[model samples]
Target: MSDHKQNPLSREMKTHAMILGSFVAIFWVTELLDMSIFRGRLDRFGIIPHSLVGLRGILFAPFLHGNLAHLIGNTIPFVVLGWLVMLQETSDFWIVTFLTMIIGGFGVWFFGAPGSVHIGASILIFGYLGFLLLRGYFQRNFASICLSVIVGVLYGGLVFGVLPGRPGISWQGHLFGFLGGVVAAKLITNEKRFYS
Candidate 1:
């Protein structure tokens, strides 16, 4: 009985896992439906640069991928970096996600090449990377600093994705998503400072 006593850390980890798992499941299910029934038509919902109708893609784009390979490429990083963001505070995950979607989507819509449709979870993945990289500096704490170091060593190579050279890749999305993550880390740390 005592062994089963509520453990806040354990409960929190479970909650984080459930949330992340649900998001990954949604991504997979949406892709399956898009490929099987929609015949990839749903991809039209992805961000179309400078089109009014495309504005809606800000909310939908992350869930839409070009193919299995694209989704598979995004899955591991999304899970790993997303879990890192949740370690400090679960609510931070939602805040960072919301900001990244809005900022990164708009950046692509405004600056991406004409007729291009930006889709995939890479935007959010970059956002997570940026947030993890900067959270330590903003928070100025030992644990956050250590976490930042670990993340930097692990994903430092991904920083190059923000550059505009990769064919068919949305570098604009990566840049803006990274910016959004920086903004989120700053905002969250400031809020904590104010509250404390």
Candidate 2:
């Protein structure tokens, strides 16, 4: 009995870890390639607004980064918040990630400067932050609400990132990523019932 119960729980833990780890690995490997072999040429794949060729960046930009500092800055928040989002349900991770990419990516593609190239995982970071912060309110569950409070307390500073004041910063990505989270929370969590 004990072994059987532990098996499922252990499997879940492994799956959760694997999923988050894969995302991190992709980011790191892509950055490594861009820095070493590609010579930063991969950055051109990032979002460029209003150009047909640039539209592909919406799919690729989240994996590319401006430099090591940018990738490092995004890595922690991306993993931490992503794992937290997964805690609700493993599937929630995929839903949130897809929505964040599509919504957040397209938002940048639409609103970003014509000549500018936006590259970084900050879009997903802000997406995870936004989903975590708003999910509780939309779901109206005690645990989710508590999680939101904790997330807010710890990462509330991320709100400032959505503003457009910083140079070379893609505030549009941050803002849209956050909004994507909101959209995910509203669409996914509202129907979920925590209590019988």
Candidate 3:
């Protein structure tokens, strides 16, 4: 057998990553523009978890990070997971991503304390990971199952993202993002077979 992983790449997955990259790039650039042009009004809109006026922050907050470091921190995983999720031949790729954002953001926005507006790629990444991993069970593909186990074991540090973090970082975002991922997985997964 080939030692290399079966390339998970496929038409649907390629499109998914492209589309996600498109959005992330656009958003990142737009936010940078906002910072440069608007004297940083764009970041003022970040999800601040203030509860009273912080709700809209959740919708667009992930787009704004403290600095290049912050932006890059979220971007890499976003791309990786986005790419992985897009690779899914299943039709729910985009749906799961969009829904994950909604569920993940809203969950934090609503349930999270007003002072804790979370934003990051962990939820989306975990969702993507969970869905892609579990999809094997639904599709009855032994290969996907193996991939899922590997992903879980390899990316185990994902669990650490949920904790309080260095200044200007939202561990809350990681938490919400993870929760969103779980919900998305359940929604997109097929029930017919555990290995589908």
Number of the predicted model whose lDDT against the real structure is largest: 1
Pick the winner on TM-score between candidates 2 and 3.
2
Ranking by lDDT: 1, 2, 3
- Candidate 1's TM-score reads 0.96
Ranking by TM-score: 1, 2, 3
CA shift of 102, model 1, Å:
0.8
Between prediction 1 and prediction 3, the one with superior lDDT is 1
Question: Whole-model lDDT, candidate 2?
Answer: 0.91
Give candidate 1 regions above 4 Å deviation: 1-5
Q: In model 2, which runs have C-alpha deviations exceeding 4 angstroms?
A: 1-4, 193-196
Please state the error at residue 2 of candidate 3 in Å: 32
Which residue pairs show collisions in model 2? none
lDDT of 1 at 188: 95
Taken over the whole model, the C-alpha lDDT of each candidate is 0.94, 0.91, 0.64
* Model 2 lDDT at residue 137: 91
Candidate 3 global CA lDDT score: 0.64
Residue-pair clash count for candidate 3: 18
Residue-level lDDT for 167 in candidate 3: 65
Regions of model 3 farther than 4 Å from truth? 1-14, 50-52, 115-123, 133-140, 165-167, 191-196
lDDT value, candidate 1, whole model: 0.94
lDDT of 1 by residue, 1-196 (tens): 5533768788888899999999999999999999999999999999999999998889999999999999999999999999999998999999999999999999999998888899999999999999999999999999999999999999989999999886989999999999989999999999999999
Provide the lowest-lDDT 10-residue window in model 1.
1-10
What TM-score does each of the candidates earn? Answer: 0.96, 0.94, 0.75
